[model samples]
Target: MPQSKPQESPARKLLNILLLVVGTVTFLGFSFGPLFQALGPSESPEASLVTEQLRAQADGYRAVLEREPDNPIALRGLIDTQLQLNEPQGAIEPLKKLVELEPENRQLRAFLAQIQQDTGDLEGALEQLQILHEKDPKDSQVLQELADVQLALGRPSQAIELLENYLKEVPEDNDVRLRLAFIYVRNNQTEKAVALYDEMIAADPSDFAPVLGKAIALSSATDENLRAKAPELFEQAARLAPPKLREQIRQEAELSAQRNQPQAVESQETAP
Candidate 1:
């Protein structure tokens, strides 16, 4: 009996199956993406917990201060939170209260000084350090820290004096010597700086800091005579330094040589 109905195309059926598979994949992705994100591994659970706890404690202290604003403990707690959070500016008010309540607390005073230093309030920090130094004149740590802060405040002369006085008691202190060299450099006494570096190198020739410092200082000298000495210092530093720094020192020496040639030519031209 007559021709049978043409069979439905297999291509149409395959296309329908492909559409169904894609639709299912889209549905699954949309549903699971946020679920996986919510359950992802956290990068800093401990810090997050500490921050949350501090916030809660801060809020509690704030509420207490709202009711009894003069409470010294509440003020101290708020100051501690601010310090932990690295918001030293925010700590100033509570610290002022703590200082008023406990003027004799040297630890509190030192903490205030440190926070002030961290916040760039060097004058305030210096005042606090002076008071602390008066209380404990023999504290080398305090002296060193104060000297460093003074240097940061553009008082390298004071830093040098402090380091000198500290070295009188703690002689053989290489750390103090290093700090003194830094102060000398800051004061533009490159000769003194180089001398200190030389002393340090004589004591421990293997130490790279002094050698590098000497090389750098010699490379920056203004006098052509002095500038001629830089390549030797750089070669010495290159030998003593690690591979990475050795390459850098060699490059600097080459550049310094290039710079010196022009100056030498200029001087020769000016000669009679």
Candidate 2:
């Protein structure tokens, strides 16, 4: 039999799919960016018929909402059908009411915020997220999302403060920590970002994420001292990443050596 390869730790396994995470990070990191892409080709021949079908369905859902404004089922249907028809502007108000009715529904709040973001209603999205964050201050999910919204609005320092404060309360959450460090990197807080990555690397050497992350953080730095150490960080990650991703990691590491960082990477756990 051919020799079997060593199994990867759970953290190491996450490295195998970094392409999806890191690639989408640039596209989805900002709430101002479209949350969902057009599902199929824009010019599909059958699109006209599909559009009519969706519009009819949406009309039906709205009729129901008219009779029962707080009806979750009808409200959800209207949001879904309108979005399917590529008309999020009409869906926002109904979504807001649905969110109000179901104050405890995290999914509803997120969906509403996503539609708001998609429609260029950044201030509205911020308002909704702030309510959710305040309603449950300890919700890690809300905290990360609110941070992303802040970053997208060009308030990275606020995002850093929010995540850092949350981290102090939940020190063991590698997921949030990873997100915080990524935000730091994006904000050009190279020293702080690298230090956080070092702490992560020390806690679980099996994780190549922070090592690769440090290289990413350093890629944007102007400091000669930080830039000098980026290649070593990249090299370290390449060796530690799983075999399946080793080559890709090495390529990114090589890029980092030239101070050519790829787009920022994000934790899938906290991706909007």
Q: List model 1 lDDT by residue over 13-113, tens digit each.
A: 22222222112212111100111011123459887787777779888888999999789878978876765654568787778678778888876776677
lDDT tens readout by residue for model 2, 1-272? 00122344555433432322234234332322334433453677688788878889888988897888888888878777766766778778887887788788866777677677667776777788888888888987668768877877889888889988888888898767877877776666767878888999989887788888877777567876777777787788878876777787787666556545445887678668
| lDDT (CA) per prediction | 0.65, 0.70
Candidate 2 residue-wise lDDT at 125: 76
Residue 198 local lDDT, model 1: 86
The CA root-mean-square deviation of candidate 1, after full C-alpha superposition on the true structure, stands at 24.3
Model 1 spans > 4 angstroms off: 1-56, 66-73, 84-86, 96-108, 231-272
Mind sharing the TM-score for model 1? Answer: 0.61
Tally clashing residue pairs in candidate 2: 0
Alpha-carbon RMSD, candidate 2: 11.3
- The lowest-lDDT stretch of 10 consecutive residues in candidate 2 is 16-25
